[model samples]
Target chain A: MSSVGAAEDPHHLAHGHTAAARDEGGIAPKRIVVSYGFWLFLVSDIIMFSAFFAAYAVLVQATAGGPAGRDLFKLKMVAIETALLLASSFTCGLAVIAASARDMDWTQRALGATGLLGAAFLGLEAYEFSGLIREGAGPQRSAFLSAFFALVGCHGLHVSAGVLWCGTMMAQIWTKGFRADILRRLLCFGLFWHALDIIWIGVFTIVYLMGARS
Target chain B: MTDTPPDGKRPWQNVWRSRIRTSLSYVDGLMRSVALATRRHDGVEDDAHGRAPGPAAALDAGGANDHAPGLDPVAHRASLIGYVTGLGLAALLTAISFWVALDRETFWQPGVAVGLCVLAAAQMGIHLVFFLHLTTGPDNVNNALAVAFGVLIIVLFGAGTLWIMSNLDTMMLPPVPR
Candidate 1:
């Protein structure tokens, strides 16, 4: 831990400088602080999701003999949704890279791709939910369904917001031309989109795969 | 340091003792140097920004960060290869998850659920590292610390719920034969 003092400044810390210790006042360049603060937001967001996850896990078996996950989950559809989200996450990361370079054209392209893929994912989800409701297995049917809807629906809501964010970022870049503030927003958007993919990993594994396995 | 050991000390024990003593002194020296460096850095932030303190002052020339993830974006500077690799690996993990769930016979029979969980964990880790770019680096200590705390909370919350709920479920009468 003492080795951290060797870093000449926090910026050098990025290069793996052997021992740059943050000063006592903890004064940092605004960017690092912002990056870290946004991460905290993302972490807090995940913690919120964990509560929903706990609820879902607890009530997963309380289906009251209504349609359980195995009867309703379609693995084929889920696989497609996962692919779409995973692809969007990847595109979002690339958009950040392009935004960092201030490459307006490619940045716009990547962000566009991210928004489109996310929209497609949400479309599939809406279809799935509607189909379930059509078959009388909606959230009102049982505790299990309710938990599933709440957890997965919350994530879908986040993705919807993220998609909207991506669109707005594109417009801002178009008008502002990769301004410093715009780029920062892009990075945050990247983090948010990636974080959503991570949550979906949990949802698919527990709610869809495990629920449908039997 | 304790003069000399009494009888029962073997030759290898003497060697081990020396190795430990040497490492401890090395660590001690490192700590001292770090302490000196920290003091040196105390009044240097402004100077580092204003003028070149030494030969390396030419750096830090660009990129004032915004209030939102700004510093990290400039510091880390997202790259093409990393995002591509992350995407490929994530896609592969998703494939394995679906494969394991949909078709169990071709793969190992037992523990399908366990395998799914393991795959999910691996995929989450890949996403965090590649897409999120959280690191154990000195600059990224805050990110690491924040995430560690968050994960601790999540594990405690989820695991506690499952444990308590399952126990309660077991204690309840079985369906009352209705």
Candidate 2:
């Protein structure tokens, strides 16, 4: 088998020039592909959310004449969730910028901030879910409750994954610095993070806000 | 023509023939109009020359002029206007959606509700086109393709699930139990 250096040597000039040109163009092909991968992942994620949306639509009135969304949903809490998630997305953007600039300190700080805000958003959601469950509206209580749990729980799970992923990336950045691989990973993470914000906008509109009023 | 198959037939031959015919007519009409315009512009000059000037010379001159940068203030203003107008439209739509969602009693009419859903979808599209810059450049092809695939899967799965679940509800839990 050829050594790594041997494999790179033949294509080194060509690849270097192309990579430099990409950088000069204000976007790296690696970064672009990484962003596309995130989008593909988000598409799969949207499939999951789509299932949740369908469930919610079918069970929107499955309250069994008990406590409906109007009774349970608090717009204020949801607003906070929105704020936290949006802020996390903003920080995730900043993290991407920092990574691009190779500013390790700012990248770490921005990613750390994103992780914290994501955690806060997840916490609020968990609180909301648990509070509803404590009030005799658990998932097992009714179909409406079940659908609600599944939908919101899925998003909460995504936020949890994002937080863990961000934390891991932050550790890698802190220890190894902003390597190309790490930057690619962070680019994917940024897309995933922002996609969540977009999904949350849908959830807020269809489930919480509309449900509350209906 | 010399590369015909042993069977003296090509499956794609029919398809190519039809497509080429359609494309040829389009190109012919376009070129004819271009020729007519050029003739009108060079009426006197064309008479002066015993024959039309060489196409190569005209092409070279045109290409040189094309390379010269021209003031594009209008395009710049148009892009700015597109951005600002897009954002305001999105915000306005969001506010209206919120208002409707909050006042559901009045907006719950079936037709109105569906309209609102359509409006929301439109607003999402506007956000994609304007703020996300999804189709702003050649490099964005991958981005657009990814988004399209994602949306297709999501819509298919979401709608399918809803349909199946609703059917199950009717079949399993009839209003009047058997």
- Residue by residue across B61-162, what tens digits does model 1's lDDT show? 211222122123323455555777888888898888888888967878578888898999999998888888877654577898999999899999989989
Q: For chain B alone, what TM-score does every candidate structure achieve against the true structure? A: 0.57, 0.47
Candidate 2, residues B73-162: lDDT per residue as tens digits? 111101223334544666677667667766647754655556557667877676555434355233456777878887888778777878
Give stretches of model 1 more than 4 Å off.
Answer: A1-26, B1-75, B174-178
Which pairs clash (backbone N, Cα, C closer than 3 Å) in model 1?
Answer: A4-A19, A4-A21, A5-A19, A6-A19, A6-A20, A7-A19, A7-A20, A31-B71
Q: Tell me how each candidate scores on DockQ against the true complex.
A: 0.24, 0.11
Model 1, range A1-214, lDDT digits (tens) per residue? 2234333445554454332212222355555677898999999999999999999988888899898888898988998998899888878876776665556777899899999999999999999999999999999999999999999999999999999999999999999886656666777888888999999999999999999976
Error of 2 at A106 (Å): 2.4
Error of 1 at A105 (Å): 1.2
DockQ of 2: 0.11
Q: Give the true-structure RMSD of model 1.
A: 16.6
